[model samples]
Target: MQNDFWQKMWASGVVGFHQPEVNAYLKAHWHKLLTTDHKAMAGEVLVPLSGKSLDMLWLKEQGHDILAVELSLKALEEFIEENHLHRRFSIQDLVHERFCGYELEAMRLFCGDFFHLTREDCQDVVAVYDRAALVALPPEMRADYAKHLLEILPPDTPMLLIALDYDQSLRNGPPFAVSEQEIHTLYGEHYQIEKVQEDKFERKGVETVESTYLLNFREN
Candidate 1:
């Protein structure tokens, strides 16, 4: 998605994608997706294209460090204030729009392009929660998005991906229709894919199917 598109969305408050509560799927299945270190688990979880989702807070409650990359600073500020964590935060860097710790939680929010992140910036990331990122991109950008995740994140990183399947003819989207087959085509070689759960529902009178996928990025 273009930076302007995202900026406008935040400025205009057109964020239907921003849920008021923690995602139920994430609440239910988070532990199953943690990275294993031969015998014990290690490393932080990455939330790419993360737009101040309360899911990050929930993840922190699970005793995991949270690293989130979002395009909008407004969303980040709102997140801090809304959650009553502003006191624990300080301006670590204004130019980068980076901050550390929130409500005494080990949380970091980087207000920048997700594509610009590097291994040095996120080497500890061993897992990802993609509740909104993949489905937010258009078709042309999806393949490259997958490639970037592979480039910056650790090889064999575990990911819990939530995607929506709907008739494209009915709506033009930031919440686009991405099928299970499309996910395979994009990340199949790099990751092992499994459909863990799914739910069907209606949004704006359009029937939609939302599915959760467990992605294990394969090692070399």
Candidate 2:
């Protein structure tokens, strides 16, 4: 999606995709991705394409630091204001030219394109929670999204990814359909993919299936 497209989505309040509460899949399976010791990962949890998600707060409550990226400044501002997080965070501008960043106690949000993020920027990220990032892109862009993630994240880093699959003829998407085969095609060479859960439901009379995957880098 174009930058303006998302900016307009926030501006016009056409943000049905934004969930009001923390995601159930995260609450259920987040522990499955953790180390054997049952502790949070060592560094920040990366949330790409993050849009004012309450999941960040939930993760913070679980003792994990957060590193989230979004293209819309309005979304980030709303997140801070709505959550009353402004009282706890010390906001600041990032040194980079393409991105503006805001920092709070244990969380940081970068406002910019996800593709513009570099390995150095994510060096400290130990795990990733991709509730909306992968499925938000078009088919042509998903490969690049996966590749960039592989490049930036450290080996053995785990990710909890949620995706939707349905007939494209029924609807256009920011929530695109990504099947299990496509998920493997995207990450199979480098990551061990596990379909942790699958749920089928009807949306507007159309059958839609949501799948969750736990991905870990394959040992080289």
Candidate 3:
């Protein structure tokens, strides 16, 4: 894994990818995967590769338990401190020696590698909110990540996976290009897949790198 890229991104505070507002797509479309037969359903959700973002709070507000996994301890610490949350947990003794969960208690953020944390650790996730998990990794790692998640998920669990589809050469990525076929290739065998959303994007700001693609998966 290219650990340096993410470590440097956090170290340098280059968090342009961290959206301040709750993701609209997440708000609107996450339920589609959670509901049974399109009827509104409520259950715990897992956010793999979650950074210090407010989306977990938003999920809690909607009455669902949220489990977010991240690799950076610094990012997780800042998230709890900035929110002024007053809860803390110790998992290092039980798991990663220093990895912990929520400081306020609504969510759990594992401050360690996602690969190291088993899917059994996130067992309650009836639905997965993969807003940025797959796209964050390089190609080789993405395949393993997807398979590992699917294997650990409860049978028949559904997932909402978001992937970017655009020319990789057009823009280098951490928001990497994960084409529709790749999503299918990675997850289609174990889940019922569909296109939940797709949008087109043209490059915008000078520093703003860009690409476009969207896909969701429902485990059968």
Task: Say which candidate scores most in lDDT.
Answer: 2
TM-score of each: 0.90, 0.94, 0.83
lDDT (CA) per prediction = 0.80, 0.86, 0.69
Error of 1 at 11 (Å): 0.8
Model 1 segments beyond 4 Å from truth?
Answer: 35-42, 88-91, 94-105
Q: What TM-score does prediction 2 earn?
A: 0.94
- Candidate 1 per-residue lDDT, tens place, 187-212, comes to 89878888888999997778999998
Order the candidates by TM-score, highest first — what do you get?
2, 1, 3
Better of 1 and 2 by TM-score: 2
Q: List the candidate numbers ranked by lDDT, top first.
A: 2, 1, 3
Judged by whole-model lDDT over C-alpha atoms, candidate 2 comes out at 0.86
Q: Which ten residues in a row have the lowest lDDT in candidate 3?
A: 205-214
Please, what are the lDDT tens digits per residue for candidate 2 over residues 1-220?
4788889999999899999999999999888888522334556899999999999999889888899999998999999999987677676656676689788788888999898888888877888999999889999999989988888886677888999999978988878888889999998997788888899999767799999988877766
